[model samples]
Target: MSSSGRPPARTRARVVRRMQRAVPALTKTTMARMQAEMDWFEELDAEQRSFVSMVLQAGYSQFIEWYDDARDRETARATPPLSAAVFGTAPQSLTGSITLQQTVQMIRLSIEVAESELAAVVDPDHAAGVQAEILRYGRELAFATADVYAHAAEMRGAWDARLEALVVDSIMRGEADENIRTRASALGWHGTGDVAVIVGPAPSDGSSPEAVVDQVRHAARAAGLEALGAVQGDRLAVVVGGVSDPDKAGAVLAPHFDHGPVVVGPLVDDLLRAHHSAAEAVAGLHAAAGWPTVADTVTSDDLLAERALDGDPAARRTLAETVCAPLNAAGPDLMLTLTSYLDQGGSIEATARVLFVHPNTVRYRLKRVMDVTGLAPADARQAFTLRVAVVLGRLASNQR
Candidate 1:
């Protein structure tokens, strides 16, 4: 009976027919809208699907007020491959993948189907409430997709770490497979020629060790070398192979930024030896000159080891300062004049021509330098000493 105390038989039958007609229309409309969405779902690779599924399910449960933790425990029984795991594998065919956009549309269509059936059970005005619920559910699904993407990012990171460990283990054990080799090759590692290891210091702002290792690997590749990168705490270690020129390699390697300091170990003949040398070289930095901090040349640190072992960074600093102070204080004009004079075999006339100054001005500056730094232009030993001093001074200043 209607609220007006009239029989509702006719009205009910009419409502039922209206709902019956609406169902097919809604289905057609929804199917058309959702067809593209399903195609989108099928477009996801396996890794993407795994991430998206988790996120979508989270939203589903939240909207329906279901206990997701319990549901997750049940779903986890069937292991979903992590997104990071498959990056090393053959790229999946879109044989079975789904996108977030499609998943949302599917859920929305399902809600519309539910609402169409509900409309027949109530007044025409009650159908408006069902529509509102469908809209709300659609919003939840959209947000769920975003959550899934973020989670997938974290999963990819963890997967990469695991893959890196496996790759390093294979190379170190000398049992690397064709696939590993292929991956390495794609990354520009060729497994030929001598390999050098580079260990860089920690950055003051806590630079990412993994990023540094990858950078070194990239540098080696760009130079047509084979390489691998690893992180040990704040330190970065790169094992390089297939490089023909060590000096040239260093030049190729220089642009990579590091935190504390970078140290290059002696080159090794094979991957295993390269790994050992790199690890030792990185450790040597602590026992070398600067300990916790240093730069590109491990040789300098090795030279200062005994003094550094006695905890005398100040001595090394003072020695460097004493050698380079004169050239630094002399300014660019004197330094250029000195360089030109050295190039001219210490000829004042040649230096004057190079500097576009009077020969007397060159002579005057030379005299002033000798007066200030006790270095005579005529003494070969003093000149050599000054040259090394100047080089060391510039390096030390750069460290600051």
Candidate 2:
């Protein structure tokens, strides 16, 4: 009898038979084989066997039949009773039987299993109930995946914004003794230990920033280094410890980043020094090397002068003014004439033709300039110095 009350004899009998037939499949043995395998089965009395068989029939056979009918009804058309949990119907046949229709049906069943088990959870009772439950779960999962994907997207946006800022902070920190020492001491960076800073672009080409960070961390571990990374606005900063040699570190890191450029900063002794060195190196690489908006693997020693030269625009202006004062004071025509003259390998005739002036006028201006700047127009070294001075003078005066 069901909870509503009265024995459904036919349903009961079908359940009972189904359970008996399924027994061999479940146990992987015949009754005789089962008895041989287990001493308990061999010793069972007839009453015991009957009792066990009936119990099995109730749970397996009856339950399965109820499950199958419900499931079939769900498949055929919309129905209400099939939706209830207790009557969740299973398919009528085992999924892997032979026959064209059976094979087709089996494939569909496999899909259902995947959808139910891997993607969403479904009950095995009344088809109507389970189908309703499937819809509910599907809605819930769809909402969940959307929420997760949205959160991941937001994280990526914020990561890009913060990446550059963090890298700047880290590099700046390394240059300062106090910051480097503190951070290094905390991280256990020490003598003969190499520190390297890596700046890379966030994988905007469809790869997850979090996955990239994970890869970087993995690379750091493989290199036996302490590594830290931050993401800011399509940029990634990674600082590593354990290697004193910047070159080796770069080589080790090159293969890890499959996409995007990576610019390496200089290696330093202590944490503080490394921070500064890295910043300088990265800056120099960008400025002197004309590095791409994206770059990888740079060191301090490689770009010290260029980095230093970039320090203060005002200072550079001041220096240029001082160096080129003598050249700038000369008349514009004279300056142009002298430049042409020098460029023409000090040939008076060539200088005159280019400037549309007489050779003697060019010679006269050259003499005056030599007297003023003490630069020998004939000497290559002096000529280079003069050219630089002239260029600097023009720059300082904003004469363009």
Top-lDDT candidate index: 1
* Candidate 2 per-residue lDDT over residues 1-400, each given as its tens digit: 4573322557544543543464434323233344554454555566655443343223233333443344354567533321222112322121112223422332233224323332222213323343443354334333433443455557655654355344446565553546445544443334346677766556665666556666766787787777656555566666777876677776677655545446677566655565655565456545544333333554544433344356634324433554356566665765786678778987889988988877778778878777766766666655655665566566546864
Looking at candidate 1, the ten consecutive residues that score lowest on lDDT are 86-95
Q: What lDDT does each candidate get?
A: 0.54, 0.51
User: What's the true lDDT of residue 250 in model 2?
Assistant: 66
lDDT of residue 128 for candidate 1: 59
- Across 35-114, the per-residue lDDT of candidate 1 in tens digits comes to 45566655555577555444433333232222112233356552222232222122222212444455456666656654
Off by over 4 Å in 2: 1-192, 256-261, 272-274, 291-296, 312-400
State, as a TM-score between 0 and 1, how close model 2 is to the true structure: 0.34
lDDT of 2: 0.51
RMSD of 2: 17.7
Q: In model 1, what are the clashing residue pairs, if there are any?
A: 41-97, 41-98, 41-99, 42-97, 44-97, 44-98, 189-226, 192-242, 202-260, 203-259
What is candidate 2's CA lDDT for residue 364?
A: 83
**Which prediction has the highest TM-score against the true structure?**
1
